[model samples]
Target chain A: MLQKKVLPRLDESLLTHLPPFSRLERRQIRTILDQATSRRYDQGVAIFDEGAQADRFYMLLDGYVRVVRITPTGEQVTSLHIPAGQLLGIAKAIGRDSYPATALTATESIVLSWPTRLWETFVREYDGFATETYKTLGHRVGEMNTRIVELATQQVEQRVANALLRLINQTGRKVEGGIEIDFPITRQDLSELTATTLHTVSRLLSGWEKRGLVESKRKRIKVTNPHALVVLSQG
Target chain B: MLQKKVLPRLDESLLTHLPPFSRLERRQIRTILDQATSRRYDQGVAIFDEGAQADRFYMLLDGYVRVVRITPTGEQVTSLHIPAGQLLGIAKAIGRDSYPATALTATESIVLSWPTRLWETFVREYDGFATETYKTLGHRVGEMNTRIVELATQQVEQRVANALLRLINQTGRKVEGGIEIDFPITRQDLSELTATTLHTVSRLLSGWEKRGLVESKRKRIKVTNPHALVVLSQG
Candidate 1:
């Protein structure tokens, strides 16, 4: 069960920095926020499930999300990891009435959501909404295309390396050693991300750890040598 | 060498049925056509190359286009096939100044293009333009997601089967024996699409031919038994 917390007037400043709201006036931003309700979710909570009715759409205000898909045989694949200040569950943007994939929280997160009925109104009335939304969609499509090419042409090792590089680039935090993927991601997650087996992922990670390429412990991974991983990914 | 053909006038009916133009008024449609130049591309002609300047965007009025991507190692992969009545070279929509992939003509094609500068105007002025366009991008993303899942979970035979089914669904034409893929797709192309070796693709197709599931001859293929393919794809 999930609980929605009543928002006591979302501040317009909260959205001014976001790309989709950057061009809108304060009044416009206020109007947009007025229609939204905010909620807090714990890490590992599912925000939505695949094939469920897309009655609402959401924007992540804090933390990370894992976009997951289940194959026909019921195998789970982690399709994407989305950072904060991004929209999710926009099935209307994709011309579907049902959610296409499941969105799970990779970290404890805060989110604001609006009824799906207001989607078209927002697109039409909001100044930068459509352009920014489409731009985001385009970026996702480009990423998917890159992943497709990787799957088709790259080896398993290269695929895994590229996946790590992508995660670090998207949500890496600088630590003492290097850049740490700023969320809890397990070896099974990496295997799903790279389309490789868990044993293969374990073997490769162990080898890379020995070579001082990465450090993994307790479901967390940090890249100690990103340049080496880049080189490995290029092959 | 490429040649641009001047149009005396573009018929409004030519676009009335297209999704992007369907919601525009007559004068609005005329304004759009006025900004566009029509061109005829011969088979195998490259409409746009990856990483090249995206100065213009186009819509395929007739025939087909193949979206190709070259890997870092200079290997060609057929990423997608676009049928007529669809948009291509939409780099601007993706926030890209350069095309992300090369679009090659699968057959002699008629295309209408406008300067990239007009993309924003179209979205702003034309009703349903942004929505329809994003919907199309969403559909592509969905397709790419499916492909990624197939690559991750399916065997070589299953991947090949899904690829054929996708092609036939997009541009298949009913023929005497069954439905023929309307484009000239070689086994090498199938190999690229499915991320398998040419030898494996040939072997699988031959085995399927023996089983009366498909017919391949002279750079063309026909699905003789789609039901069997659905079964094969499920596994």
Candidate 2:
């Protein structure tokens, strides 16, 4: 229904840079864009909830969405963040009956969505799209395998160092001191990320700040010594 | 090519139960079976090494394969094990240039392989195959997300309990004592799976045995009280 009420067609040019679409030829991109409906959300809005019927999936045109899951203990953990030009809610597109996690907009965001019914049609028509999409999923599984290994073998200090390094790699902004994480993340978020307590994350950041290895203020973090962090993460 | 070596044709009926193949029609299954090559490996043999050039992916016909990744510190960790009827080395078939982990035969195994080049051909021709394959990958990603959350938030005991339950669900055998994990898996494997230490896993298993929660000897484990594990994993 959103498709029928679209104000104006999304620029076909934006589709050229997204996965599945990026793999599409010009005409194939046009065909998909014709069926897409664009929507915007305010920062901190829930895009979809866990256990919701998975009828559609979204492609981010701008901004960020964080995937959060509530454990059996009722603690919420943000598992991953989706950046611009990437797809989310892919479980539905691949035949899952419901979403496994809640997706919340981390910032004011724009997303282009398509009904799940069209997923097979696109795959049947475009080999590149399906291949690229599945490849992305495979890469994610590989990354999580690495994280599991890290959590299993590494010390808390090392885990924190690794988490910071990964964050910087994914969304770092170069600054005078070093590379600052480009997202608004708190110590609580860092704690959830590194499998540590908030106190532990705070202490580690403080110690790193004292050594000029990192700079932190409020919700922001900057890795001042990337090499040192790498050395520490290796432990 | 293995298919041309005439080692005898793979059983077409087995293909009907495996993914992608399972989604295919009888005629389509025969078409794919014609291109598949059956090979056998001895227990502990390396099926594929991490970083090897992508060429082919396999479907297990018998036995198991353990997916192992070596850390930057030279520690090898077994990330997961794939039992018969599941697919492996799928990254290559989905556009990745190389295997992300080393896959070793956990037991003497029979596998049917298809060259990566034919992946696109199958997807373009078979909507069922593509949908099923991508669905499998999506399920894997979802599983990993759950593991990541557990590692990030759950305690070591809880994680161990969760891992054991998951393994039993995947490959449990009913026994007089309880539900036994139907595979050869050592304490070291348990340690790696739960992100704990060998000593810790040993100690925890011993403590659980004293409490009549589980029974273990060498590489085998039996859950005498599955309900306890469920409660523990929830913590």
Best by DockQ: 1
Error of 1 at A215 (Å): 1.7
lDDT accuracy of residue A84 in candidate 1: 99
lDDT per residue for candidate 1 within A1-235, as digits (tens), equals: 4455456667888899999889989889988888888989999989999989999999999999999899868888888889999988988877778888899999999999999999989888888787788678778878888988999899999999999999999999999989999999888889999998888999999999999999999789999999999999988
lDDT of 2 by residue, B106-222 (tens): 778888888888876876787577667667666766777787888878888998998899888887889997999877888988887777778999999999999999999999999
Which candidate number has the best TM-score?
A: 1
Question: Where does candidate 2 stray beyond 4 Å?
Answer: A1-9, A23-31, A125-127, B1-7, B23-31
Model 1 residue B122 distance off true place after TM-score fit, in angstroms: 2.4
Best by lDDT: 1
Q: lDDT value for candidate 1?
A: 0.89
- Which DockQ values do the candidates obtain, in the order shown? 0.66, 0.56
Per-residue alpha-carbon lDDT of model 1 for B15-116, expressed as tens digits? 989998899889988888877889998999899999899999999999999898998788888878899998888887767788989999989999999999
- Tens digit of per-residue lDDT, candidate 2, span A133-164: 76766665666787778876789999899889
RMSD vs true structure, all candidates:
2.0, 3.0
